[model samples]
Target: MYKVTVYVTYKDSVLDPQGEAVKGAVHRMGYDSVENIRIGKYFEIQVSKDEDDIEQVIEEICDKLLANVVMETYRYDIQEVEI
Candidate 1:
């Protein structure tokens, strides 16, 4: 079996309103030290070892469903597990 951890985030050129809002709230709460904040998504996927190419599978899924390639970017980490 394989375990995949995916992280999806807005592109650097894209504005992150949610992250901005949270940063504002943090400032109000007296945490001025914060420079900025970026909101993102995380996904965990499990695949059978029978999948000949785990990396390829993960990349396709991330491109199609896990992220919006135009405005967002994605990265993933994979680990093999004992069946």
Candidate 2:
């Protein structure tokens, strides 16, 4: 078995409204040291395949379907899991 961790985040030029809201809240709560914040998504997938192959497939999926490369970036890592 393999476990995959996928992280999806906005591109540098993309606007992150949720992250901005969080930053505002943080500032209101007295954290003046906060500079900037960005919101992102996380996904965990279970796959039955060789690590290298699975990683390639997942990367393709991210590039083709799961993420918008112009506005967002995605990265994934795979780990073997004992059942």
Candidate 3:
């Protein structure tokens, strides 16, 4: 078994309007120390594939669909676990 952790976020060069709006709201709510905010997506996948193939499958899924390479970037970590 495998535990895959994926994080998808906008590239540093891209402007994240949603994150900015949230940051503004947070500041208004009395947390003025908040400087910057970049929102992201987190995914935890449980796969019952062979150990050797888990990494490849996760990478393919992230590159081809989960992340938009043009404007967003993603990183993942794969761990082997016995279920």
Best by lDDT: 1
Give the C-alpha lDDT of model 2: 0.88
Task: Compute each candidate's TM-score over C-alphas.
Answer: 0.96, 0.89, 0.90
Candidate 2 TM-score over all chains jointly:
0.89
Q: What is the per-residue lDDT of model 2 for residues 5-74, given as tens digits with 9 covering 90 to 100?
A: 9999999888999999999999999998999999998989898865558867888878897788889998
User: lDDT per model, in order?
Assistant: 0.96, 0.88, 0.90
Worst 10 residues of 3 by lDDT: 49-58
Error of 1 at 23 (Å): 0.4
The model with the greatest TM-score is 1
Give the C-alpha lDDT of model 1: 0.96
Q: Per-residue CA lDDT of candidate 1, range 1-83, in tens?
A: 99999999999999999999999999999999999999999999999989998999999999899999999999999999997
Angstrom error at residue 28, model 2: 0.4
Model 3: number of backbone collisions: 0
Error of 1 at 37 (Å): 0.5
Better of 1 and 3 by TM-score: 1
